[model samples]
Target: MKLKMSIVDAFADKLFKGNQAAVIVLERWLDEKLMQDIAAENNLSETAFLVKEKNDIFNIRWFSPLCEIDFCGHATLASAFILFKENEALTSIKFYAKAVGNFEVYKKDDGLIQMNFPKREPVKVQEFPNELLEGLSIKPKEIYKNVQAYFAVYEKEEDVLNIEYKSELLKKLAPYDVVVTSASKNREYDFVSRYFWPASGGKEDPVTGSIHAGLTPFWANKLNKNILVALQASKRTGVLFCELKEDRVLISGKAVQYLEGNISV
Candidate 1:
């Protein structure tokens, strides 16, 4: 079978920056194993697969090389970018995920794709697991946890940047990734973060949109602001514009198409 595939760099204005996601548009759902195999072959952070349910609505799923994940921000943005480019009349698109429920993406007048994602607010944890601490070279000032990952709060941006981790130790924190973040010293951004998911994807994620959903709310409350700018300080850096609403978060960023072609399976 021949399927259409697109590779997009989300949260970036140029190529080789930000997170790369593989997006495959299908007429119908493929076998679960087949999708997983495709994702593994692609070897990207997250590969998104979608089947059109109706006009402007799609049934979406995300897979890492190892397993299926509940939510993914960059791949969703990449899918919307492909759809919008294909159909100019499409101002917006709705996506339904089995685990994350329904979400919408709108094409802003300024040419940014804005996604309305469910807000994930994490509460402070009194104690962190031993593995969590042993995995990192530096200790955090405080720690918090949400449904997806553990947030390790640090005092300085340099602390976040200088972190080194043992991937084997991080694997002990299975099913939950770790995010090390701190208030940005640079005036251009409000906060900076780096995501490590050795148990699932890899040692690091270039730019994580889902984690920012939690990061936005946490920092917004700390900074006493509703809107904020975030930077993921990985080797391939990216920026995100985030806002915390009552029950949802608005994550907006620009995506650039890296490669487009046909994949035969």
Candidate 2:
């Protein structure tokens, strides 16, 4: 079958500067194994698949090269962008996704898309595994565990920028994904972070909006702030405007379309 696909760079003001996601539109659900194969073939951070459910509603799923992820923010943005471009006449769209315990995507009036995601509260863990730190040059100040992944706190912002480690060791130690975050003393940003997910797929994800659901609240409580600016310090960095609401976290960013084409398989 031939499928229409596009690559979107989410959280980017320009092309080639953010997380790249492959989006595909399907008439019906493909076999789970085929989806995995397609994701592996794409070899991108995340490949999003969607099918029309109604006039405005669509079903979405995200997969990495290695495994199916519960949620992926950048890919969702990519999917929305594709829909907007393809169906230019349609101003609004809704997506019912299996990610993040069943979530919805809304296309906004101002070209900005919003996703209502689940709140993943993190619990403080006593310590991190020795192997997890052995490969890295520095140590995290604290460690916390969430349902999706774990957060590793660092002491300095410079440390976050200059992080260099062995991906193989991190993959071995971490069960899922590991987030390296630090309080930014810099006046520019409230926090700086890097996400490493050797197990689930990408070695270093450029910008992770879903992880912020846990991170925004954790830092808000620690620093006693309601709204803050966050930076993801991967090779392709991003600036996220985040707010900690009573029950849910709101993550906002800009996305750009990188490529649009068709794929045959």
- Each candidate structure's TM-score, on Cα atoms with residue i matched to residue i, is 0.98, 0.91
Off by over 4 Å in 2: 54-56, 88-92, 107-111
Residue-wise C-alpha lDDT for candidate 1, range 1-265, written one tens digit per residue: 8999999999999999999999998899999999999999999999999999867579999999989989999999999999999999999999999767999999999988999999999899997899999999999999999999999999989999999988999898888999999999899999999999999888899999999889999999999999999999999999999999999999999999999999999
The numbered model that scores best in TM-score is 1
Count the clashes in each prediction. Answer: 0, 0
Clashing residue pairs in candidate 2 (N, C-alpha, C atoms within 3 angstroms): none
Lowest summed lDDT across 10 adjacent residues in model 1 is found at: 50-59
How far in Å is the alpha carbon of 221 misplaced in model 1? 0.4
